[model samples]
Target chain A: MVESKHSWKAWLYLAPAIVLLLVFTVWPIINTVRMAFLDDYSGLEEVGGTVFNFGVGNFIKVVQYQRFLDCLKTTSILCIATVPISTILALLIAVALNSIKVLQKFLQTVFFLPYVTNSIAIGMVFAAMFNIVGSFLGTENELVVTAGVINNVIEFFGGTHVNWINVGSTYAANIFVMVVYIVWNALPFKILILLGGLQSINKQYYDAAKVDGTSKGRILRKITVPLLSPMLAYVVITGFIGGFKEYTSIIGIFGETMGPADASGRLNTMVGFIYDALASNKQGRASAAALILFGIILVVTLINLQVSKKKVHY
Target chain B: MADNNIVVMHERQMNKVKTASKVGGVAGKVLTYLFLTIMALIILFPFYWMIISSLKTLDEYRMSVPTFWPRVVMFSNYAEAFTVGKLGRLFLNTVIVGLVSTLLSLVITVISAFAFARLEFKGKNILFAGLLATMMIPGELFTITNYGTVTSLGWKNTYTVLIVPFLVSVFYIYLLRQNFLQIPNELYLAAKVDGTSDIKYLWKVMIPLALPTLISITILKMTGAWNSYIWPRLVANDGVHSLITNGLRNAFTETTGDVNYPVQMAAVALVSAPLFIVFIFLRKYIMKGVSRSGIKG
Candidate 1:
């Protein structure tokens, strides 16, 4: 390619972003790959040496780690469960909001409120809403009650009172609480995006259908559903991507512990597990886990792009 | 007489149908509003609960049946949050980090966006495409190595650790670049013919044209800094250095004694109020920013 004469000035302008990107993004990725291939780099600093095993040992260790597997399962369950539920709910909300004449902006602002608040802070509120704990330091730690609205409803429906937060053999109840929180948190953005998509649709389509005396359900199915596919795809892809990295909300509800401890006392998500590994000087394992997560995200995103290309109307 | 009677009957039937449809229209509007109001209440309830719980006393907060509103409003809880949780320091730290990083990041983003948009350089497309590819990779991957780099640099517990890594966002650069491209190249050429420097032309002309996108970036970046928890918690989750979000993790909890849930809720409320106010007032900018990112709706 013929280079521009102004390449010098352009480089000057691009220097800051390039430098920061190299340090923070590019170099870190290279380092992660290198570390993931090697053994743990613990104590190498003191010895002024480097570890270079350069095998699949780290990957093997990551897959074999029970906590990592559990964390992956938890993450997958959350992603699979929340993404569709939230997308459908958001789509419905958006369609309703779009049809409305009054208080649309007001409702929009209310929905978007969750997007602005810190996840951890809101997670705390959600955690408290789901359970009523006994007095701190009380010997009657067993005196915990189902103070949360959802658990109370469950109790009313002839279901036994369960510690929703501290999930035991039944992971369903705990997963349910997590899904609800995530769905609520995810709604505002998805709704906003879907609303935008719905609004972008031309009025002529609806008018033509109305002239033909098309029912509301038919109009939505024939007109709204096809046109809104692009946004719906976008929401699903991003939502799934976000769901995989689930960390802070868990921390918000369960403190730094992430969730209620299992038999091994490991309540980790994918990101949380990575953080824990890195913190505890298990650099190789952390890097491997991170790289695995990256691969999954990349695959999921690519698959979504491919699927949407076939399905999305525009 | 028969023809006249048929005409009257048709007219009556048409009028009745019109009246039924009119009533249905009114009912539909009412139903729409009813649905919206219920959803709005559900969406807004957590924020309401946060504020009310903050105002309740310890006993009221832990009641067998939660009160919809506080029995007694504890205004002192706010004061207690400030002093007891050292929220004043956390607020200051958060504000400093947010403002400084946002301003610095803006400078980098504007210049880089200008280069990619207006300036023609070798491999410009390739470089930009490479950067775009990085967006596909989840950011958690970077934290793995960036944490090690920061710790090695002895930047832990320092503002440098908190602010430096995140000061450049590829997405923001891409957004500003798109915005800058909309400004005609003729203006830049016209200024260049006058012997104006690139930086001078940028300051005097490009910035004014792209002011809306610039404002969007600033507000979003600031809000991002305000809401950041995990990274800050990882590197600087210590006294004075802790961000407001990280600081609230367990600041109001009793270390070895009874925990006052109300007081902690008060701390959360304190941390949340600024963002809520910002969201309310500058919502247009935030909404516009998202819409402009080519992800409209």
Candidate 2:
């Protein structure tokens, strides 16, 4: 009898969360899959209780869209480029931080400063850094204005200023700016996790290595890397998941166009594609694209797990 | 005599080795500090740049060559950004959404976590597992449908739209549930023996024990609200319901399609200030919350 009473009380406690979750979480997952299969089901049209036929037309349409392909390519490229670069850099920095005795806390705090920052705000700052102040009026009659701070630095180093994130800016230049920003944003969390992992490691392992007169490089390569593998794996997996969802940073740097002037949507990612679809009231296509992105993330995560299983020391 | 000579030679070699290692250690320490300092400056450079740019005159900002420091310090630019951006309104909306959503979410999280941790509910394990499974699915999937749901429900341009859809975070529930489980069950049993209700036991004992995690959750939730962009941009982009981010984004652009760079920078600086202050003061809670979630923005 007491057990039954407790069960009822538990249900009462769970009532609010359950109701919200049913509406927001459970229904959405089912609805995303439902809408993905529907043939161009507009949310606005659904208000009239229009019965839509179920098919894979939405998915087919999304796949055939060139911009969607471009989004996939951008998302993949970003994930491929930023994850390993940030993870390795973070590892090196964390190991260096662990070895140091002076100003370690101060440096750690400084490095983690970006973690608390608003990305949109910081993206604007970066945009200013790489932004050109003057206008490009005509094809041949280009008005030379102030190059951004970064270009100024390049000019100082005897290198010509490259047009970055401007009209006629190369895809390579835009991607470079984005890679720098993403890596900068990614570093702090990776460092924190790895540093926490490093601290928990047995000091006696280092003591033994010291007594053995082991070279520092050798010890790091042979001992530190293995012990730190689990944290590294976690960081890499999460980095990829986060990287695949890249959207707002582009908005911050390039405004809602998602790219440089006159090259709008050139740097659009999967999430951006879905947003565009949704804004155009193409719920069917948006849901299809969302499912596709989810599928990609799931596959990539599984691959990460398999790879880590083989390679991770833990 | 030969043995004594060998001993002296060995001593000399050892001294040379010791000095070399000592020099190597010092050099390594120097290199470490140098690397850290450079990295620190690089990490902090954007913030430095944001501040200086915010202070620069428009003419100086647009000069053919960038000025490292502004020739004319424009303190008035802040005032301009503030009024033009309607930052006061945005700040109020953000605070209202952040505080209301956080408080409500905390209540839901606590009760749900209590049920999961301490109660004898049927299918509790399965229900909890179902919630955890939702975490793996990218949030965009839900967002697409939620947008439709909210729009159909006539929740546009309302605080209810911002707060209601995101009230029950599975991660927070899981986090708090883990925290609740750490408390000894004997306390609950004793409370029960004394005819204490579950809610009373939760308030007096469980909440106090889990105060740190609760604090962490509150800070994270509030910051999450403050930093939210895409959702608010979609559902509530009008002047009446605009959040800080969307307001700042379009606030300083002129009719000619040119952004007033310095004023925009000022707006961004003002927008970032509260978060920076929160971080400096409640950094432990924020970090704890972040590390626990392992979810990056």
All candidates: TM-score of chain A? 0.89, 0.95
Model 1, runs deviating above 4 Å:
A1-3, A40-50, A135-146, A149-161, A166-170, A261-267, B1-23, B252-259, B292-297
lDDT of each residue in B49-99, candidate 1, tens digit only: 778888988877766666778989998988988888888888999899999
Report the alpha-carbon TM-score of model 2 versus the true structure. 0.94
Candidate 2 local lDDT, A1-314, one digit each (tens): 24466588889899999999999999999999999998999988887788899999999999999999999999888889999999988998898899887788888888898888788878888988888766554568766667888988999999988878877888989999999999999999999999999999987687557656789899989889889889989999999999999998888888888888688899999999999999999999999999999998999899999998998997
Model 2, residue A187: distance off in Å is 0.9
lDDT of 1 at A201: 95
Q: Considering the two chains of model 2, state its CAPRI-style docking category.
A: acceptable
Candidate 2: stretches off by over 4 Å: A1-4, A48-50, A135-142, B1-20, B253-258
User: Per candidate, chain B TM-score?
Assistant: 0.87, 0.90
Error of 1 at B282 (Å): 0.8
